[model samples]
Target chain A: MHAYANPARFLRIARWLMPALLAGGIVFAGGALAWGLFYAPAERLQGETVRIIYLHVPSAWLGMLGWGGIAAASFAEIVWRHPLAGVAARAIAVPGAVFTAICLATGSLWGRPAWGTWWVWDGRLTSMLVLLLLYAGYIALAAAAAASGANRRVAAVFGLVGAVNIPIIHYSVIWWNTLHQPPSLSLSGSSMAPGFMWPLLGSTLGFTLLFGAVVLMRMRMLLAGAQADSRLRRKALSAGEAA
Target chain B: MLKPKHQRMVLLAAALTALLAAVLIAAWALRHQASYFYVPSEIKAHPPEADRSVRLGGMVRRGSVHNEADGVTVDFIVSDGRADVPVRFAGIRPALFVEGSGVVAEGHMVQGRFEADNLLAKHDEKYVPREMAGMTAEQARQTVAQTK
Candidate 1:
């Protein structure tokens, strides 16, 4: 873990990993989406509408996972003062927000067909909405901190604090009498049939890989910017000394 | 007792733990408000004032759905096994709003019956493939009703 504290070394590793991850992500996400849309059997009750599960579940998973990543990176930034941790947290925010948005949109579409409403203030739905809002808030806070040249720890602290919502989002349906159903998948097993399960798993893996690739790409860009900024500063200092 | 960075880490963990505890307590205290709807037994036990609007949710009793003489109105009984609440709604029912399926109706109680302004269908977590369903739709309905 500490070996990655060196920016050049991190960039060296990510240079190769980024394209590999992207290619793998595209292959798996594309194949799974195709299978879910074209080949997966219709649900007994929901029919073709059930196909949305492939996108919705994975997006939901990543929405939470993204926050989890932010929390971990923030911890590293604060505790260990890991050099790349702030960059990693920043890189994760946009993709996390995007996934959260996708989850909400897909869930709304599914709800219209399955739940007879486009929106509801139920526990599960509301908490997921809150997760999206938290992402938005985090993005804005992180941006503001960056612009003002404020301490990045301000955003890292928020990242750590915001993590309390993840568990609430996870257990909302079970804790409250929600209109949305309980989770279809859990630690014990899944309620979904094998026909839907395989494609959903494949798509989830694909999306996760895609998410990682985006984060790495952003980190690389941020690191490159910092390195260039430092070199320019050094050049200016040398010029001033010569004068 | 620890390095400065380690001390900060411990403090951060404590603060987050306290925050989580606070959130959990607040949520627990407001659990009733967090619930989207009340079941029949809950309504019977508490019986909110007739004009105070609330959502009543449960399964539609298998044989209780009836279309009133008015073209717009439908009447049905929502049962949570132990109790039942009769509901009347004047709106287009959702495609999934079938007998023996879950429903949530929003409105107020009038005399004894619930007068619903909006109706939304609810579904269970089960997701069987069409081929694996084995039972006919009617049989599936009956099975759902029986499970209640």
Candidate 2:
């Protein structure tokens, strides 16, 4: 972990990993989309509209997963002050926000045909909304801190504090009455048939890979921007000293 | 007072505004396709104009269910216990949709009957998914007896 904490080494590894992960994500996502859309049986009730679940469920999973990634990265930044951890955390914010938006949008779409409402103020929906708001707030705070040259440690602390929402988001459905259905898949046992289960697993893996690729690419761009900014600042300081 | 950093912040604000605009427009465009729910009494009193898709929800009347010749399409009565409405849906019924059970039917009102394109079983506090909260003691016993 300490060896990988070096930004140069992390960048080197991510450079190769990003392309492979992106390619694999595209292939897997395409296959899952095809299987879910055409090959999988139409929900005996919902017909074609049920195919939306393939996209909706995966995006929702990634939204939560992206937040978990950010929290873990933030922890590393705060605890060990790992050089690249802050970058990892910062890089995830945009994609996390996008996934949260997708989750809410697609969930609303699914709800219309499935639940007969575009939105419900149910426990599950409310908690997911809170998750989106938290993501937005984190991004805003981090950006403010970055632009002001405020301490990154302070931003990392904020990240850690805000992460308390994760478990609440996870357990909200269980804790309160909700219109959303409970998770169909469980670690203890399989509730879904193999046809449904395999595609879901594939889609989840694809989504995870896609998240990693996007984060790595963003991190690269951020590192480059930071390096250029620091170089310009140093040159300006030297000129001021000479003057 | 507007420094380079302040200008960057303004740019971020503009980007956020654009993002919000895109999201709102997308939501609005899809609003008609979104789902709407109604109780059986509501459907009975104000049946939506023909061909407008909607959902009808209520308890399944005790003995009004009948298996159709096609076997897939079933005719049943949904009641608030005060007012009853007939529903015809050609699809697999949800596992929990039975007599005395709360149910939601999705489709449109056609002719005199509520023609459901989809069926969902709504559970009460007493009934939750087995995987999450597990079955109640009564349900557990019933399952055990069925296995034997």
Best by the DockQ measure:
1
Scanning candidate 2 chain A in windows of ten residues, the lowest lDDT window is: A170-179
* Chain B TM-score, all predictions listed: 0.83, 0.61
For candidate 1, the per-residue lDDT at A9 reads 91
lDDT of 2 at B94: 61
Q: What is the lDDT of residue A219 in candidate 1?
A: 90
lDDT of 1 by residue, A1-243 (tens): 789899889988998999999999999999999999999889877889999999999999999999999999999999999989999999999999999999999999999988888999888888889889988999998888876778888899989998989999887888889999988888799876667888999999999999999999999887787778889989999999999
In candidate 2, what are the lDDT values of residues B1-148, reduced to their tens digit? 7775456546544654565566456545643333235666667777799979876767889899999998798999998866778999887666557777678777887786898887876544232222323455577556545744
| Model 1 chain A lowest lDDT segment of ten | A189-198
How accurate locally is residue A99 in candidate 1, as Cα lDDT from 0 to 100?
98
DockQ of each two-chain model: 0.57, 0.04
Count of clashing residue pairs in every prediction: 0, 4
Global lDDT for candidate 1? 0.91
